[model samples]
Target: MSKNRYSVGLIIVIVGIILLLGKLGVFGFVWGLFWPVFVLAPGLLLHFLYFNRVLPSAVLIPGGILVTCSILFFLCTIFGWSLMAYIWPGFIFAIAVGLYEFYTFDKYSPRGTLMAAVVLAILSGILFGVTILFTVGIYLIALVLIGVGAYIIFGKRRSW
Candidate 1:
């Protein structure tokens, strides 16, 4: 009769059905694909609790981080794990997202929260650039050099 009981019952029934379907091969592809949702759901629940005023706004930080990490995890699952080498910057960006969310939502946020968020975002960008450069090898450097050369040739000259 209580909300908790109803929620538990619903969850049990849904899980039971899913297991049944899995045994029957009805969810062959979907069964394996959705495992990351388990990691993502808790993050979403935290955000929902924060919005509903059941939890403090501070929850946004971990919630954002978890959600971002879960998405990246899912990507790693779908793509090859080798992609993780280049995508590791996502972990830094996840923290940045969490910090930014906390800064935006917490009225009494710490003084350096915004600064920390900005720094983390910049660090994430730098890491991502470095990763791309490493992954792409000399091509990226050549492209940059060509762009610089084109700028020097065609860019407007300014008087100093």
Candidate 2:
């Protein structure tokens, strides 16, 4: 009887605390910032499962994609959505990461998947560079070129 009474008392206290926290809006604040952890947790769990040999290595494909994309999402959320324009190629890079993980962990260790991963990685790199060049990077590149040209025109020529 005392045990039952104690349990009921603990439950009432816990419910009171939860109600107080909810009324204070802590849930909203925490959810807004940490929602992506929902996405990241399953990916990490899949990785943990595979590493523990409880699941097949194939799970790594989705695991890698989820983990990578979650990190990217977290970065965008923390910084600003505008950064997505500069970093959109990261989606392609996420696929490459998934394929690379699958290639790495699979028993067959297929070469084709590795090649695909490499190609996707290189493509993502090229796209990322091009996107940068089209955005703020153009101004930076122009500034560098102008500085070099000004030095060449105004400074004495050195014998090489």
Candidate 3:
């Protein structure tokens, strides 16, 4: 019983069960609902590998991006593809998430990696803000700006 043999056996069993369930019409109402899981599974596998020390920490970046993209895809499938217009910044955010994960898990934190994450985060915020301003209206933007400004100016003055 080698590991590869066990893994192959498990996968075959799982597929057989799924096929049997499908034939039984158990997934009739949810036939297409979990399509994103296929995309997400690899990302999860990458994370699992990193956690288990099977893969280098650098893999977290692409893994995070894949996971985030899968969630965005799922959201679009459920809500509407039109939502992508406003949520496109999520792609940038995903990259930022990957960078942050790498920084967190890597033994030697490079300055450039952290800086890249910060830049990506800022870009994502700007894109999201522009999308909101255009789609929601200027009034909400004004309110948000005022609130953010207030927080920046006064938030640190308060002692927790």
- Best-fitting candidate, scored by TM-score: 2
Q: Which pairs clash (backbone N, Cα, C closer than 3 Å) in model 3?
A: none
Cα displacement (Å) at residue 79, model 2: 0.8
For all candidates in order, the CA lDDT equals 0.92, 0.92, 0.91
lDDT of 1 by residue, 56-134 (tens): 9999999999999999989988996888999999999999999999999998999999999999999999999988988
Q: Candidate 3 at residue 40, lDDT?
A: 94
Q: What ranges in model 3 sit over 4 Å off?
A: 1-31, 138-160
Model 2 agreement with the true structure over 1-76: per-residue lDDT tens digits = 9999999999999999999999999998788788889989999999999999999998998999999999988998
Ranking by TM-score: 2, 1, 3
Task: Residues 1-160, candidate 3: write the lDDT tens digits.
Answer: 6999999999999999999999988797474677888889999999999999999998999999999999999998888789999899999999999999999899786879988998999999999988988998778878899999999987878668
TM-score of 3: 0.68
Clashes of 2: 0
